[model samples]
Target: MTTTRKPGERAGLTPEIVFAAARELLAEVGIEAMSMRGVAKRLGVAPNALYAHVVSKQDLVDHLLDDVLSAVDTQVATQDPSSALQALMVDTYDVLLLHAALLPAFLVRQGARGDNARRLGDGVKTHLESASVPAERVDQAVHVLIIHTIGFAAFASHPNIDSNGYEQPPAVLRRDFTVGLKWLIFGMLDC
Candidate 1:
């Protein structure tokens, strides 16, 4: 028996392929180079051809994040939020170490409609919900956790800021941030 392949599948073009290629581009050429035109050229496809797989540059970015974040794994994240968060934090920190160009790009927000921000936000929200954290405070808690994680990654990586100033290495900053994160969260639980 013979099996048929999807139009894009045969060409090795799928949302996953788009995201993976984009991520490699992000690491190699920075976020700006991950455009549809660039990605198409990287994949050796026409610019319009990428549309069927990704809607926009923003869509590609969000999908890239989803693909990367999913690597953190649902089972581990679901087991214990605070602990899970700690693991997630460390894992993302490592990713940042490898993909320094994305430190700032990953931090950008597209407002309430932004999917990448919501991805991290919703993960923290789930943790709070499971912990029985107060509904009124869930949003706030999630905000703090997400910001702290992203900040820790940013300050941790400490990417070159327009080649003007230099900051401490991510490992050093993370040393302090990791300790501080644990202390802060532990202190909050006393409430």
Candidate 2:
């Protein structure tokens, strides 16, 4: 038996494959199961083989989060800040719906290093500044928005972690979350 390559055959893998495998695994098993060994097993690679692509579990996690962030359509991030805020929230919540467990770890992480995190953070802030949000308050508002959106989804997804955790969400829960969001938007503060 022999393995062969045509001419320029790929390694049949990339950082993306590693990340996607991790994402799907995380969605299926929660963050606690996101070990490098697990990801390697899912990818059919030996544990040591993953080192060629990811430095450590943390590096793999950071890469996995980057893949998720890339999945979010951030057009709203470039639109006018007020509506952009709402739009960003909507999209963030959408991502949270599928990957809620990944939120706790990735939400506060700016990224691995210096400007990647700072740059991403600043670009988001620029929209707030562009919208004329009081310079002092934009950070606070972003914090609240992150909390509400992720917190809401985390609470929403909590029930699905049990052995028989695959039940449908109740209509009442849907109504309450929507109404709560509405109240937060219109009835609570005079933004």
lDDT of each: 0.66, 0.62
Every model's TM-score: 0.72, 0.66
lDDT of 1 by residue, 75-123 (tens): 4535766776666566656665566566667677422234544565676
Give the root-mean-square deviation of each candidate in angstroms: 4.8, 6.7
lDDT minimum window of 10 residues, candidate 1: 109-118
**lDDT, candidate 2, 1-191, per-residue tens:** 88764211234667677778887787778666668889878988777767767778878777766555554555563455555655665666676667666775554563223333344355557666776667777677656555676667666666634356655464444455556665554422345
* Clash count, candidate 1: 1
* Top candidate (lDDT): 1
